[model samples]
Target: MSADKTILIAGTYDTKDDELSYLADCIRGQGGGVLTMDVSVLGDPKAPTDVSKHDVAQVGGSSIEAAIDSGDENVAMQIMAKGAAAMAAQLHSEGKIDGAIVLGGTMGTDLALDLCSALPLGVPKFVVSTVSFSAMLPPERLAADIQMILWAGGLYGLNSVCKSSLSQAAGAVLGAARAVEPPKRDRPLIGMTSFGKTILHYMVKLKPALEQRGYEVAVFHATGMGGRAFESLAEQGAFACVMDFATQEVGNHMMGSGISAGADRMTNAGLKGIPQMVAPACYDLVDLIGWQPLPDRLQGREAHAHNRLLTSVLLSTEERREVARLMADKLSTATGPTTFLLPNQGGNEWDRPGAPLHDAEGLAAFCSEMRAACPANVTLEDLDCHINDDAFSEQVLAIFDQWVAEGIVPEGVS
Candidate 1:
């Protein structure tokens, strides 16, 4: 941190006053500046804050006098959270801070969540929470790319445990802000989705092909959390075009699997009107469990474990067709040029001939339903090759080239 980047320190200062002050001094010791925002509900902070509780509460449509006089703890915290987010966001926009760190037990964690999400991507958002990376905190609740560390033994005071977590978190934020260089936006970026390389190898072919055409490429794996990040960034208009080749998260969500990426899995890029081509990659099997023992509830359909955390279970023809209809329904609302690529031979690795999960009838049922349900405003292409086939990659590149030539995609320099 030779440039001395400013790090925003936000928390319930009344409860964690000594902790927050120690953190500020630690960061300042590392040659980084600090901006403090107090989000305490009832009491006053021992440390001075750039944004005071009175100002923050007023900004969040509440008065400190009212909050202190009469209110529920949760309601007061909510008001403070809103105010902290507003003040933090304004500071960030004015370039007063390069990154932010928020510390909390539970209420503080909830308050920090809002402040973290309020800041945009590329700002180092970190949370030192007692519930760091807990299953209770869903990926959607945190901003994309937020880093979290467990606040071990940090419930009450400044012990060795608190010092260790705070010290590491302070260093982590500075390291992130200093090391990250802005992206080279010389070319239009194309986002491509994939799963295991064995299943969605077209990612490899698509990347170089798009780069050859003077476009940049970003690939997102189709895991549950990965899907959320991809969708969130797309909503921010990060990509000029998207090759949505691996869409299993949608089916996973429909099946109520833990591998779900929420209900809007396959709709973000379409809603943003970015030129996009979608394929049925990895839609063959719903992810169940990995190397772990299969729960009795997940019995049937030729389950196979891919790795420690990925188990695939086959979907019947009717189930596959139903997902296809749902997907087409979502695509029908696209506001920009969209293409649904139907790879007639197969969709996922398990759908090929002689594979344990292969179901020709299921694939055919999906194709029929998809083609019939596709909107007339959207384009549909039926290809004879499998999703991972070389021909599929070729077709995607060709479509991208045509989109660029027609000015549907802005021409990007290498």
Candidate 2:
């Protein structure tokens, strides 16, 4: 394949030959190069392709016949994703690709997304699948510059809507390829997290403050995916330091709030030994979908809806202690200089005086437990102010500056 503007079209050429050919032609007609790879395990493809089913099986460490013979669709799909990712990684390493596209049903979409995930972010990745809307493959794993989820039926016999969707998707892919450019660095990379309630606060205050500090702030919404993305970037050494303000997701996971970041969220920076400043920014409550949607055990407990989108379930004394323990466990793993700032008055706006989820006793329990459990290497400080207080913000920034200074020249800057 030509390295310049080449698009890798990966899928089962036997089943998707017509659609694949149509896509390939469309890409070529747009003055772009195209390479097709067959990922089908069962049949020989009719189209002339750069990579065949045999090639994937060989790279994937399994035979196509063996996959087909297994009769297990899930296993087969996993093999395809693994093989396709391996192949794509190899091609990427060779610098022979600029973009990629794939078409399939549920299985095909899964396979393509896996391969796409293997590719670096910002690359053109597209998937035209029959089950795009119904299928729930993780979009985070895909490798394309843009993902266009088209609603269509089986790959065979296209309807008017399907044809229109495919055409639009093709245009999007080509447009992405032509328009894609490297990100410009004019701002410092500041890592920030927020939920729907505090989003306005972040957009107004913390973001502007960081930008004023001559840093480009990368904000991660405190959803599960946002936290994962931030952690992923940290693992890649992408941030100078992280200001993990909205750590409420930790509570989510702790309380089974549908939005947990799992165990890996806070561990990345600590393991990477990056300078970090953390806070119980919104620790007063674990987020749920709605007040009535809470678990039966949690029913009648103090709950408040921050907005229509988020319901906050107040943490009990027991839950607070558990969250504190988990926080301490995560903090103990830090390899670099770190600080945990506790806002004595409240963690979030919702936990302040006159707020619905406020619980001074529970908050105190959490802080005390964390202080007792935290390793000596990780500094713990309690501030007599709310999280949004300017004093708190200044303290965090000062501590961050000190950590950065220590990291830059460990012995003494003087």
Which candidate has the highest TM-score of all? Answer: 1
Cα lDDT tens digits for candidate 2, 1-414: 432478888988877787777777777777788778888877767856898777887789987777887899788777777888899878877977777788888788888777877777677788788766442544235332337567465467656766677677777777787788854544446677766545225335666666665667778887666786787677666676778878888888777666655567788887988778888877767888763477998889887776776777788888888888888888888898788888887777777777777787888888888878878878888898888777787887677567656654122112
Reference-based lDDT, residue 351, model 2: 75
lDDT, residue 67, model 2: 83
Instruction: Identify the candidate with maximal lDDT.
Output: 1
Question: Clashes in candidate 2: how many?
Answer: 8
- Tens digits of lDDT, candidate 1, 1-414: 554798999887888899999898888898989888888767888756898888899888888777766757887788888888888888999999999999998888888888888888889989999998776776566676778999999999999978999999999998888776766677888888898777768887888877887888888888888887788778888899988888988898888777766788888889999999999887767886575566565576587778788888888778888888888888987898999999999987777899887888888888898888888767999999998899998998889889989999988775
- The residue pairs in collision within model 2 are 116-143, 123-145, 124-145, 125-144, 125-145, 187-216, 188-215, 188-216
Error of 2 at 384 (Å): 2.2
RMSD of 2: 3.9
- Write down the TM-score for model 1: 0.93
